[model samples]
Target chain A: MEPSDLAGMALIAVAGPEDALAFVSSGASSSAALEQEMNAVLNDSGVPRWPGLAAALLRWRPRLTDLAPERDLRVVERLGGQLLVPEDPEWPVALSELELNEPIALWVRGRALVIPEQKRCIALVGSRDSTSYGANVAMEMAATLVQRGFTIVSGGAYGIDAQAHRGAIGAATGRQFLPTLAIMAGGVDRFYPTGNEDLLRAVAENGAIVAEVPPGANPTRYRFLQRNRLIAALCEVTVVVEARWRSGALSTAHHADGLSRTVAAVPGSVYSANSAGCHRLLREGSAVCVTDAADVAELAGAPGTQLTPEQLGAPAVHDGLGVEDLMLLDALPLRSVTSVDKLTIVAGIGATAVLAGLGRLELLGLAERANSGWKRRC
Target chain B: MEPSDLAGMALIAVAGPEDALAFVSSGASSSAALEQEMNAVLNDSGVPRWPGLAAALLRWRPRLTDLAPERDLRVVERLGGQLLVPEDPEWPVALSELELNEPIALWVRGRALVIPEQKRCIALVGSRDSTSYGANVAMEMAATLVQRGFTIVSGGAYGIDAQAHRGAIGAATGRQFLPTLAIMAGGVDRFYPTGNEDLLRAVAENGAIVAEVPPGANPTRYRFLQRNRLIAALCEVTVVVEARWRSGALSTAHHADGLSRTVAAVPGSVYSANSAGCHRLLREGSAVCVTDAADVAELAGAPGTQLTPEQLGAPAVHDGLGVEDLMLLDALPLRSVTSVDKLTIVAGIGATAVLAGLGRLELLGLAERANSGWKRRC
Candidate 1:
């Protein structure tokens, strides 16, 4: 193509290297065509694009370069309807994987995403088969990290990992805005565990949900270990929440040390089997001793002054989620359904939002207009 | 003095080369008495001594020939205790305190006073506030070392140290007779931490209790750390049982490492505050890691082979300590007074043997005979 022909490309720009690669591979010269082709690729890849994606892409064009559009578009499509790339202004650079097995793209729908470039963004990792003792300790440390204004990063797995993310996200403090970054091994569509879907969704909506693998990709054991290295690399420190003697947590610690990052370990009872890996790390000199997130933040060279709850960050603040609203949402039929007063008694949302919310839901495509009043559609 | 008189005089030994100057100043002949007077002078000087003392007269001995001795018995007395003659079979020439703060003379005791020439002895040490886990581990390693026939050595404190002594003393194989030694900070007579008094007595009876300080000296905190170098010097391997962040155990470990002795440590729970010192040692590369006694024994180069109970050279195997005998021993009055009826009820021994045993006990100086009956002297 001539240099003059390359000038025909309109507004929105992409800066991500992966998006650049995807655009070049699609053989599209214009941003609009590139986006449509990217969406096609997502459909081909078995992921769905969001409804307002084209409009959102156009708004992001003035804010980002040509490559940013492709990457952000792919991210939203891959995450399904749960997450949307709300803006380019509040995104985490720490979640950006640099080349080697990078995150194909990031899918986030949080209130804020503020991962500072110069500051350390550590991810505390450990086994899903964590002991109760480990889980409690992970929670305490995550809370402490958030209180100290250190963004708590982790894999959003069950056990210790889940406790860590929950701690940072639930902390009343507002300093933990985009501080919590969850690097999942699987795709970003919905919660993988189903039990933790609400938790994962909370994290994505509050902080950020990140993945190196694209959406619809299932997390494999190998990917789990590979993702650990990312956890170590993105932050100045990596903490092992709890690990068995032969656990992937040890691998993450080793990766942190290899990257010249500080590796901290929480000690456990001498008899606790969950602490064996940490003991091994402590014995091997691969990890520093840490009792709380403050220790980690200190190791990361962050001063340990604690932030107030309001100062910590506003990640989990939902605009309108109440008990009645949830009860109504849960009452909806799993499959498409019909009937209004019958649904009202079961939903308990009353006549007010039920009428208004149904229209809003219909507009959102979550509910479709049907025979009687309306039918719920997933 | 005549030339023949000079020939008749034994070689005068000064505490050090500088010590002779005092002898000359005292107007004593440069004979053995001169050395005695000089030692008395030096002992009264209030100068402190350090461990690993080989000798103190560094090339200055020849400059003080004008010294003199006055009496012959004083000459023998001076040479007997103050000087260790190489011709004396009790001398262990292989024990060298090179480059370490050298001693004027080592106060020696025990069977043979034999130090292995060109062989190595390793020191194992750790916390007095040890967990049961650390003690058991220390014992196993001691037993293993005994099997390998390396001399097991340690401080005679409670916890790991006491266990080490017991393990070494209980060596069944007799592969290395008189296999254990305890180095004390205080005088060998005043064992600190009274709980270990019985164990110390057993150690004294089974092996040896050594101290660099003079007899009847109380142990100060400084002296405990001061004597650590001797532990390091006497052994080729040092095992740490368990220690808090700040304990005497780390001092011994550091000394052993400085002296180039092999240092090993038992790994403990990461969460335990007591094992923090051990963890720190492991972190600093001051000690190798060991899980069990076998691991430590292997590090100590101790031998272990299956030896039947019969093959074990137990001093004089007695059946499980009989309750009746213990009662008899316990029944002895505070003073030397006892009645036959009391003896019968106490011992439950037959009339013949009770008398015979009493007679034997009397002979052994453990009992005394009075016109009324018999009583325990001890």
Candidate 2:
């Protein structure tokens, strides 16, 4: 190993996050350079120590001597993963925007594909105990977004997160690089929540499994909170599908909000406890409510761009409709069947006009007669 | 009948809405005074006629000569209703805010009680073909608002409207003057949707049924749209519980928005067709999402004051909790059970702290362990 690599490994092993941050902010090019500055501060009687620096250096000196950088490198290589430093070509530059809170290095498992532009990367997160309604919404949104050439990023946990990864994988068309990415709290060598082992392995094979810690690190409570900031920093927009009040997903949303990234949340029934966090976010003006892939795309700065020619199958015959017919068509319910009387009320048109419009729509294959009355065709 | 009454009736019978508006805006206190101005307009050849006034006068001349005010009065009186001119003490002053569209007179059924101040009235409108979810939200919101000393106002149609009135009646405590008001599209004497006859009659007994036209008139498509303005004008806030795209309830919301009244909408599942209009309103920045009565009340300018001392039974023991405990309590799911592990994730705190907080909450009867996990108590 190079001397700089050995020094970087030692610093990561012994120094606290704030210590590493201070070292980098001082313009130290390498761990050895940072150590030299620390020694100068310690040796000079007149020079005052920076707040929290001297104490951290004194505390970490003994531990740095015990760390084995070569052995750690061997373990990472044996697990088919690699350590990524700031100099690595595959390093995500967006994390640099985090400044002081940025990770010193990243442990990555999977192909070292180039990180796409921020606009094409999105983070989807939510409650681990999400309802079926929430899970379905997350899956549909992920699949549709992936097909639109956007990469999906999420935590590889249960419920909404797991569904998001599965949806992206299912919708992969073999064209986009790294269709999904899972940022884990623990080491990339072992997936937490053993129940998601297969899913995480699939993700590692096709996309990436990433962590801030070295190999053999266990997922802890504090690490999860730290992991959320990385997800927020990596993407242009972060969407919360469903979260009860205080759900960890909200932490990701807040971090995204703090970073000035677009934060969108999927709204659910007001009565659903699982949606309480999302509603609170909407109520507090912290997040915009997004219903589908188009809404998400719009928030990500790509408005009016979700529906391409190939995805739409065939062009709709909307040009042929008159003003009244167009109003009636827009009034038609997408799901529930509606009657002529109700249609007249909804369209604010006369019964005769509504009936005539319905007839025209039916002939055009845009509407259909149901037992209840009429419905819009999918 | 008096001569003034005859002239007033004659003008209503023959003049177009614009002509009537022009006559009213001319500041003529009595029908006799308006007739003198009409004659002056006719005698002067050089003076240009106000836009549509000349054509309207020519069209109504013959009809005015044939109408009888006494017979119209008898028709209204025989139906156990009364006519309310602008001179009547029971007139709702808020309708004046509509300016050009304000009704010349209101035919009112049931008791001629004084119309409450605008701040005390609320309008709840939605699709006539409502889902069970929509109806439930409407009913709960209406009932809760009524219990908080606000009158519920809505169209007396089937689905959401009927449920609003029923909920208000069910929650009446006999403390407020009028518990509910039904703004009819047709004449006050004849209910438009016969299915709601009993409900409308009950509303007439406990509150009032108001209309712009005289007795024996049928509800027409144009009248329904016009009637929406009255509902919007009479209330301080208009809440759309559920509406499909282009539903008439949206007309009411638009009118309310135009009048600068607070427009709120209840959010539902994205998959629900009934909530599509509400969601659209939220997306377009036309309405705010409202979950409960307190939310509606807050937008109506009565923030944090929904529940009365008598209604609260006993104050919650929240003051004793520390900051972290309060956060955990707020994060607790109202309906769905949550586990301690999930709580820790949501609170972004240590698992040990969450476990300790849960134990304290259980002891205080604020939270309890459920089949799935922990949940807040009602």
- Please give the RMSD to the true structure for each candidate, in Å: 36.5, 11.9
Residue-by-residue lDDT tens digits, candidate 1, A252-339: 8887787677887776654556776776686566777665555577777876446434323344322244443434454567566756
Candidate 1 local lDDT, B58-159, one digit each (tens): 111222242233342243234232224334565444334423233323443343245443244656688888888777767877776676666777889988
Candidate 2 at residue B221, lDDT? Answer: 52
Task: Pick out the ten consecutive residues of candidate 2 chain A with the lowest summed lDDT.
Answer: A1-10
- The lDDT values for all models are 0.59, 0.75
Model 2 bad stretches (over 4 Å): A1-51, A58-66, A87-89, A303-378, B1-51, B58-70, B78-80, B87-89, B303-378
Tens digits of lDDT, candidate 2, A1-378? 111122333344456545764563454343456566544544442334332333333323323433465776788788777888777777888887765456777888876535666888999999999899999999999999988888899999999999999998888867547879999887788977899999988888778888887776657555676789989989999999999866889999999998898898888887887887887788777888787888888888875655433323344456657755866787788899998876765554556667888999999999999896899997
**Every model's TM-score on chain B:** 0.57, 0.69
Instruction: Report the lDDT of model 2 for residue A172.
Output: 81
